[model samples]
Target: MPLNSYQHPCPGGYQIQAADMLIGGTLGARVNWGDPARDVVITAGHLVNNLNAAVFQPGAGVPGENQRIGHVAGRSPLRTYPSSREFLGTRAETPGQRITCRYDFAYIEVAGDSAATSYRIPGINDTDEPLAVRDPIEGEPVHWLGNTTGIVLGGHVRDLSYWMTMELDPTNAANRQYLSVQPLTLIEVQGTMPTRGGDSGAAVVAVNDRHIVGVHCLGGTTRKGRPFTMASRVPASPQALAEGSSSAGFDEVLTWIARTKAWVNS
Candidate 1:
């Protein structure tokens, strides 16, 4: 079957389909445990919450035919922040329902079977070497691994420090209720690395390298009609992850996975 026929976006890996397929909507990220002894995956909370009845395939080719890994029963609360009104306006809203801004991310626990074993990416086993988060040097090659175009799309980071506003709806009464959103980590790319509806939640990794600097979470067209991508830093510092570890959070997600799941075989 054509890859686009599948429900999820693509990055072309045995586990990519397995992990991404279990997520709902077009947004979800692929995560590694940084340990080979145990198996784990991470994604947005909204995606997993909508996946209660979904089955997780471990190693199957294509989007929907992977081996059953597990199901997402509980998830850390996390919300996907869109980059524009057009994107948010496209979503369905209901009355009396509250949207969560915190914990917009979640982690999946996988069994240590052959399928999980085969999903390993070497040199990811060590957590000691802190991942690099250097600014993209001009003319330096970069890449993003996302389900864009129903497959993994890669391109160089064309520009940096790009900024734009998006729409946001607050679920709580405290703080600013509604406002336009802005992000600093905007990126541009060339070639056929077109991002589409389901490409959110991908990792913006350095090309030919294992360093993952940002997460592909949003996209939009510029005033000039050119497409661009946006991301938030993974927060390399321990202190930063601690502060924003709750909603629209990553620190809590990663730390939660570390405590709840046995990613490293003891």
Candidate 2:
């Protein structure tokens, strides 16, 4: 299905743009791990650096009305520690500067009523099946519905720990910063779908049971010029958001939404 266009009860795998940023990324998944029927929008950390930033859909031919869907709720620092994310730079990175992170994923608290969202991932699992989450298994076939390249298939987890840097580059009207992250359980996929811009934040899923696996964070050529597609493994544990890890890249973000987040109002 064409996901770039506006969708009511916006499901997973749709285009999302931060109102303050010029570019956009995919809202990888609609995970309702709370009391609400449709609770949060999950995506890459860089897209939601500023918590509470307004978020909307960049749908073509769709009128501009009712576009403001939600706001950034939480994010995990993509870099830190020999055991976990702490000590060193633990703040979420911003655009226009290089970032060091351990887990490159974040979650947005969905606003409005339950009708405003759906957990279904179009073309992959349209039913209201209980969405399961897990870490990516190497060599297992996978699928991800990207806003730019819809319904990507024939891919499998290749690398569970790949170091790389992510950047928006020049010409982007907003967020022209660089992101440099360590291995941190980076899930690399190699196969049919050639990762491209706007595909960032796409959720990497297993083809067998459609279990949510990883967050497609970024992709690019290595110093040797070899192309690579990378993602952050889905949270196996979000304990204290990795603040207690004595080793590096051991935790992933998810604790904030595992329970409804109590937003601290100013």
Candidate 3:
């Protein structure tokens, strides 16, 4: 459960949910999903499957049942496969398809009369315009927020292409077990960022201009035991995604955002 919760309107930096699973962040209630352009919210794609389509605020069974704010409208795929080769992990492995690995994002369709939402990240955004956003650069100071650690600051983007091999369930005693070795490209945050299990989809904001650059995915210790955080570059304009470094795999939602540019605030 949330130790602390922000008031309504569903702005960035607060807690959101998918059934009982605590997810976070909503870029804004703006984005064209279909016929009657519905409001759009952003988060990690892995958390947006059909089973957990209904989104609740605070939690599923919190103060009341009216906390549902949206449903899964679209999601970038997070595909994985059986061990192609014993390249990374011991035992068995499910390496992510290179294309889906670097693109971990999803969209939520809010109700027509839902409470207001904003793209602002409190303490980070200054103006009323959408949260300034782009990809993170190496060695740049950064910030991120989530239910686990709200508003972590003074961290740097350590690496832009760090790959990992992770256990399907880390809680198990086996450390060599692995699954979903994803895209080789990832934004690595320097130092232990204080993020925990609940902070998976947190947005990594660049200190300069407070740009929402990367989406927080996973964290771990270096071989020497130093901490580091990994994130995927935020999907940007179609031009940026095609010509820029956002990689492939976000074309479905990104194309919609580009086509409906006026309504989207990403």
Q: Which candidate do you rate higher for lDDT, 1 or 2?
A: 2
Query: How well does candidate 1 score on lDDT at residue 87?
Result: 21
Q: Highest TM-score, which number? A: 2
- List the global CA lDDT of all models: 0.39, 0.61, 0.52
Top candidate, metric lDDT: 2
What tens digits encode model 1's per-residue C-alpha lDDT throughout 61-141?
A: 555464444445334333343433322342234311222232233344554322432322122313323234433443345
Instruction: Give residue 141's lDDT in candidate 1 (0 to 100).
Output: 55
Q: How does model 3 fare in lDDT?
A: 0.52
Better of 1 and 2 by TM-score: 2
Model 2: how far is 121 from its true place, Å?
Answer: 0.9
